[model samples]
Target chain A: MKAKIYVTLKPGVLDPQGKAVAHSLHDLGFDDVADVRQGKYLEVELTTPDKKKARADLEEMCKKLLANTVIEDYRIEIE
Target chain B: MKSAVIVYPGSNCDRDMQVALRKITGSEPLMVWHGDSDFDKVDLIAIPGGFAYGDYLRSGAIAARSPVMREVVRRANQGVFVLGVCNGFQIVAEAGLLPGALMRNRDLKFLCKDVHLRVENAKTAFTSHYAGGQVIRVPVAHFDGNYFASDDELKALEDNGQVVFRYCTGDGELTGEANVNGSMHSIAGIINKPGNVLGMMPHPERLIEDILGGRDGRALFKSLLKTFPLAA
Candidate 1:
């Protein structure tokens, strides 16, 4: 099975990288952009094809290692 | 005093911390690898600064879950003295030993220079050497050093006096930029609920000797040696 995890800074959390990107985009003449928040997209390949097990394992990975639950949220999609 | 310094793969300040410990305690500190399961019967454990694991994913994220941190957490729960500096502070916060997370600097720049910090609460094991409101000059070098915590957490910290340091101007007044990384409530350092474990973004190890700059950081080590009880 293959999985894709999207990790993002939660709302109200400051995202300096995202703010810098927004500023650069504005300087480049893209004035319509209101805000930009950057996030991580991780693609993982797993040996098991079971979605249930994969979801559980991915949740554990996010909680224990991947995502910092204090400031970030993660969503996983298994295929 | 017997102290141990946890060395991670990318830790660059382990030797500096060891030297500081040795200078004050009159004994060499044990260099424990990140894979070590045992703490080697030490009174103090220091997680020094540097881009641990190259600051991949997030600052201090990978290093927080290393094998040694598991042991560190266990010992910390037992009331052992633990100090985390800069990246080490981020690791401790990520490990949930302390609350909040360090985000990138608000200016989005890697700040590297000496800054003034006020000793907000000098009652903890880490800052007992200084008087409350005393200002000390320490160098902060980091990209992601902004500390964030919720309102309730901030209220709790203030109520319990867990806040230890706050950024200040040269004259000892809190200023906007002096809060270097935009830490909430201007918090530069804080202790855990138990007050034994301390995490701060400033590197006291770098300022222990006068040759580096000033000796303001020396008193911290001296105070630690004075207050720490010998193992029974």
Candidate 2:
């Protein structure tokens, strides 16, 4: 099985890279782009066959290593 | 003093940390690899600044989970003195040895220059040599040096006098313009509740000699000797 993890900075956390991208987009004529918050997308291969078990395992992974709960939040999608 | 400098795969400042430790204590510090789990019962352990493990995942995220860091966490909890600088600060915070997470600079720029730091708490094993409210110049070089913590945690740090340094002007005034990386409360360095472990973004090891343009950082290293005279 494969799991897709989306890691994003928590709300109120500063995203400097995202801000830089937003500035560049505005410079390139994308004025309507109000904001751009950058995040991480990770794909992991797991040997588990049970989707429920994989999700639980991935959540633990996110808590332990994938995401820093102090500044980031992560969502796991198992496929 | 028997000191150790933890060396991760891409740790660039381990040698500098070693040099600093050796210069101050007249003994070379042990270079412990990331894979190592034992601390060898050293008096001090330093996690120097650098791009450990190519800073993958996040700045210090992967290195925080390295085997050596697990040992570091255990030893730190046991009251062993730990000094984390720059990337080291990120690693310690990620390892849960300290509060707050280091994020990218608010301006999205890699900062590398000397900044002024005011000693807020001179009671730690790291800053006992610095007089209270003394301003010292130290260079900060990193992409992710902005410090962030929850409001409650910030209050707790303040209430417990855990803040050790604050970014300020050369004249020792803390102002918005003086904060280079947008750290919370302009915090440049902090110690754990017990004050045994310290994490700071500025590279004190880089300014230990007058040849390096200043010797303001030497007092920090000397403070270890003051804290533990036996280690001297």
Worst 10 residues of 1 chain A by lDDT: A46-55
Which residue pairs show collisions in model 2? none
TM-score of each: 0.97, 0.97
lDDT, candidate 1, B1-232, per-residue tens = 7889999989999998999999987878999999887758878899999999999989999898888998998999998889999999999999989999899888888999998999988887777789889999999989988999988889998999998988999889988878988889888899998887899998889998779998888878887887764432
- TM-score (C-alpha) between model 1 and the true structure: 0.97
lDDT against the true structure, per candidate, is: 0.89, 0.92
Which lDDT value does model 1 have at B82? 91
Report residue B114 deviation for candidate 2 (angstroms).
0.7
lDDT tens string, model 2, A1-79? 9999999999988888998999999999999999999999999999978998888889899999999999999988877
The TM-score measured for candidate 2 stands at 0.97
**Residues A1-79, model 1: lDDT tens digits:** 8999999999988888898899999999999989999999999899987889889999999888889988899999887
User: If you superpose only chain B onto the true chain B, what TM-score does each candidate give?
Assistant: 0.97, 0.97
Q: How would you encode candidate 2's per-residue C-alpha lDDT over B1-232 as one tens digit per residue? A: 6889999988998998998988986777899989988758888899999999999998999999998999999999898889999999999999999999999887778999999999999887888889999999999999998999999999999999999999999999999889999899999999999888999999999999989899999999899877766545
